[model samples]
Target chain A: MDEAVSATAGARVPRTERGRRTLRLILDAAAAEFGERGFHEAGISRITQRAGVALGTFYTYFDSKEAVFTALVRDMSMQVRDHVAPRLSGTADAIAAEGAGLEAFIGFARAHKEIYRIIDEAEFVDQASFRTHYQSTVDRIVTRLRRGAARGEVREDIGEVHGWAIVGMNVFLGLRYGVWNEDGAPEEIAGTVNAMLRDGLKP
Target chain B: MDEAVSATAGARVPRTERGRRTLRLILDAAAAEFGERGFHEAGISRITQRAGVALGTFYTYFDSKEAVFTALVRDMSMQVRDHVAPRLSGTADAIAAEGAGLEAFIGFARAHKEIYRIIDEAEFVDQASFRTHYQSTVDRIVTRLRRGAARGEVREDIGEVHGWAIVGMNVFLGLRYGVWNEDGAPEEIAGTVNAMLRDGLKP
Candidate 1:
């Protein structure tokens, strides 16, 4: 987990602020390349060109195309966490926080629609990263659910299974409402799902 | 959708029972090849070898590798439906049927571990098939939910969003419980999710 901060998988850790900026540039460029062209067609030189950096600079942070894609997957995972964390912090009730988290995620997904393609493609491009990404996300949800349980905001016996279900619901809701089509406003969509979470779908 | 019965993504329809058996063998072999080696590295000859058919026989059905992969995705979708649908029909209570469906799905996923990889790869190999697989699955869920609503087993307003949310939950649960770890029994996992779905997660 500590390694996640400085580097992802085999990516080299940047030593300075400028170096970090260069790594970020490379990752952003890689996202666009991989997201649009996919892993097989996406090339290192094209990623470098898109990043507006030299090929040597890419080697400074990542050893190969696979390395950068792995790093990008990790970066996106963190990006999603960072984006939704603050919004959750502002919420007190666990259920309310879940709703807020979902709305914020929908907003994030809409803004970075390529996240879906990139993450889904990780299955073929880098299988380990793909597994890690989902495992980590579900772990985060389990932690939050346990925390909510301790505070009596959620069911006392809720555990990993519940976390997986919520994560799945949020992921699909994001896909349908955020990535595929913006059928409803993010808050509205979140509210609808939250209602179902708050009450059973019983008539 | 007419072509879906005989072919997937421009594949030729088989005319005879023998032809259907051959097509079935090819699809099963394609699933094995694509599921294990993925779309790019999975070769036609390998599929033919696995199916005990000649290369000409492979061509008699599928026009290309992409076509077979696409067909496999659709086939898996049907496989999932066929596996779960009968189980659902045996249960009278719609809510209870969903739990049965989930448990059956977890079992299917456990048995067909490569299913996750192959279906996920469809997003990259054939976008249309990928979309169709999920769209059709969610539609089936929507129809079931509406039927439940009519029977007063589910809420009347339970519609597409609920269907998508439930699909997402079931998919992720299958990934974790069935594919990744199998920490809990399918019945246990389904029971837990069904409970959350049956009642709100309120403390």
Candidate 2:
């Protein structure tokens, strides 16, 4: 099981600027390695080599490859939310609102396809990490929906159930569009998903 | 890319009694192994050993673990259709029809949790295979929905959009309830899903 770190833990203060830079180097290297080779295939030694850090220094921050992956998951989560947060605030009509959310979500997915892949494979690599990240994403979306509902920006009919519905739809789209690249471009698929959400899957 | 079937020609006869028996043995063993260790962890040797077959004999039926997984995916698809066919034929009411479809889908998922894992992991293992299976499942469900709409047993507004929506919902529920055992039993989750489907996701 992947251990959950306090939000600040992954970015814990370094004794020096050099220490901070080294931590970023390690994480960036770890992310690249994991993205290319997958969680199981990416080893600690390789990650250290990629970061140009001492093997012993790697242990100072992360317990193992699983820990690095967990930190990466958390980092990606923050990145995704940061990317979408701006667009999500200050929306217009229902159609525009839905469109903005879908676009923002899909845009983030498009830009960070590797992060999505790593998170997707986390299910097979470690169930705890998968659930943690999955639930956190869902919960974040649900919170947004709740906020919309409160503001009377969303249809009263669409409630928590609708949250799950949107989550389900977006999840499949993310898997198909980014992880699998099953069909059309991420933007094009995002349009279809937005249409379905607004029109109730009617023609 | 994993081979869908072994290169050896006529290694296992299709539709012949002996071939059918061998295929059944291979499929059953694959399912069990996949259930116990997931797709990546389960090996072809373990499956063949459990099935009381030699290594070469295993390849005679399946080119690799993936080939066996492909066969299992196909078989599960057929089983799902069989389970839903009777319900589709019996229902005339739109809400009732949707409920029946949701229940039948969940029932199939519960009964074949291992197969569901293989299908889900297809995202990670082989995107091409994942898309092939995904499109096939979507087409089948869309056909049924179109039939229901023609009979006035489903909302006329529904189309491929709803097809995608329903498929997305089922996949999410199956992963959460059936595969991961996240919160509730499959049957209970099925009821919640059916209700959401029959009625709109309004408050």
Candidate 3:
């Protein structure tokens, strides 16, 4: 890594603990503003005011509101990825572990419900970039399914089909009910989907 | 129904033939532009230009851009409901016919891909209305599944679970792959969903 480049990147700031705190403030404010008012309506000035930072200082950290949203999405995606990584690693059987896996997934969604909404709702904001960001996670999920299949857990008849099906199911459930509509809990929906997958969707 | 309200509501346009044609032109142009550039970016001026209507004339029917979008969604929803209604009339024993129902639904998606995108992307415009629109259709699908379960055509284990799973699968598949990314034909995705449901999701 270029230390000079890194230093230059940091030099815009005061190079103190306060600088880091201010950066965090801006990110948190940006996420909340984007989540509540949406991307189009959430202005940079509002974020600056919310962050309690000068507008120009926000520009020093993030070039634009779009950049802030992108960073927000990336941070949330990695959080979700990290949450699932370990639980998915040591499962005894693919079919058997699906229940626990799904439960954990739903638990994660509940824990980070707002972030999930920001990401899902982001698709309607900048479709091209949001699609790219979503697809990266989708690809990872597909790979995880494939890994399960290789380990003799997932059924092979319709791996790709089931892959997309499961992904689609999670996405829809998360978007429809998980994020904003807390009419029901996330685990209930996950349990419902798990049962459907386990026994086949006959009804 | 009041004949005046009925007539005006039927087309949401003036009774004159020329006015009706102009309204259709505006709706078509709005749909195209909305699909291409999304609701926020697609301007009223551009819509009038595309429809070959005066700016004042465009406002004669639609009160605002959102009003135009609402009209388009309403019209498209009616079109889809009409297209799917005939095929869904058969009894439960007619699994083949039910399969055809899935096919018909996919066909509607394929034919009106942009309209599907409009609905999928509507969250950015008016999320509550979009959810209301989709929730009713989901309720109809759940009703169908309940009917199948009542007739002993569906498994006894979990009817509602499977119902929502299938609904969720169809929706996101259509939204993600069919409407936006569109990697495969809607019929193919529909077929895969049907097959997975039929034999079960197991190996």
Candidate 4:
């Protein structure tokens, strides 16, 4: 990977730990601002104020509001992946790992509900970033399924269809159990899906 | 139903059969216009022009651009329901019916790829409508699951979680097979999902 190319692709690469913290603050604040007021209505000054940074400092990292928003979408996507990864360690099989991932996702979504709005808004705000977010996600799912197939833990034919189907299930389950009602616990919601995933609806 | 209240709820209710036809024309045109230009950029005049109706005629039904967009979302939601409902007629069971529904949906989505973008953008442009669309769809799923449970066709415990899960699966499957790529036939995609729904990922 070209370090300089990657650094220039988004916000300026911070040299120190303090600089990294500042960038993280900006992104968290951007999520709040965009989540609350949406892209067009959200203001950079407000985001800067929320980030506890000076007005000039906002420009040090991000070139414009759109650039920051794009970066934030990428940031949130990684945040999700990172959040779900650790939960898969103790699973008995790849299918169980998927359930763990879903459970963790619902919990994460509950904590960061604005993620849905931010990502959905990306389709309208930055089309390329929006496509990248989903394509990369589906790509990860495909990888997991293929790996499971190798171990004989899942159907050998598990591919794009299964990958998309599982992702879609996790997304809506999170929306319902994580965001909308929270009527069910994450474990309970995830368990229900897991059961369905491992054993079909046949009675 | 209260005719006046229902009429005021959306656009003006078309009176004569000819008026209904014109209303349908305007809605179809609105779909094409909004699908192409998106909500914020799409204009009332362009929608009217595409519908082959005069400018004043547009206001006879829809009050403004936002109003037309809202109506179009609801219309598309209904169109999807109507399109898929008939395919369930001859299914051997509710599970089979669901498979048929998925098949019909993929076909519908492929023919009208913009439905995804339009409904998704509703989250940003019209939050209530977006929530309404998905909630209603999930509600239908819940109803089907409950019916299946009563008939002992599916797990008796299936509820909101299963409903959202299946809905999510259908949606992503449609997006993958219908919108982004058309590599797989509708029957093949639906069959794959059906097998998973029937027997899951178990080898």
Best-matching candidate per DockQ:
4
True interface contacts reproduced by each model, as a fraction? Answer: 0.82, 0.18, 0.43, 0.84
Tens digits of per-residue lDDT for model 1 on A1-203?
58556355568887788987888888899989998999899999999999999989888877788888888988898899999999998686778888899999999999999898999888778878888888888888778767877887777777778888988999998988899898888998888788887664221
Candidate 3 vs. true structure, TM-score: 0.80
In candidate 4, clashing pairs total 0
Q: What do the candidate models score in CA lDDT, each in turn? A: 0.84, 0.65, 0.66, 0.84
- Predicted candidate 3 versus true structure: per-residue lDDT over A1-203, tens digit per residue: 35323322322444678877787788788778987788888999999999889998988787777777776776566666677667766666554345455556666766666675577666765555457555665676566656666765555544445565666666666655655555666567666666556555222
Candidate 3 segments exceeding 4 Å error? A1-23, A86-92, A96-98, A105-113, A201-203, B1-22, B86-107, B156-164, B180-182, B200-203
The stretch of ten residues in a row with the least summed lDDT in candidate 1 chain A is A194-203
Q: Sort by TM-score, best first.
A: 1, 4, 3, 2
Candidate 1 CAPRI assessment class? medium
Tens-place lDDT digits, model 1, residues B1-203? 56456355456777788998998899899889888888889999999999999999999988888778877888888889999988898686777788999999999999999999999887777878888888888999888877877887877787778788999999999988898887888999999888877664221
Flag regions of model 2 displaced more than 4 Å.
A1-18, A52-54, A93-99, A151-161, A179-192, A198-203, B1-11, B53-56, B93-98, B146-162, B182-203
Give the higher-DockQ candidate: 2 or 4.
4
- Residue B145 C-alpha lDDT in model 1: 72
Residue pair clashes in candidate 3? none
Evaluated against the true chain A, what TM-score does chain A of model 4 have?
0.93
Candidate 1: residue pairs that collide: none
For model 4 the TM-score comes to: 0.93
Model 1 bad stretches (over 4 Å): A3-9, A200-203, B1-9, B200-203
lDDT at B173, model 3: 65
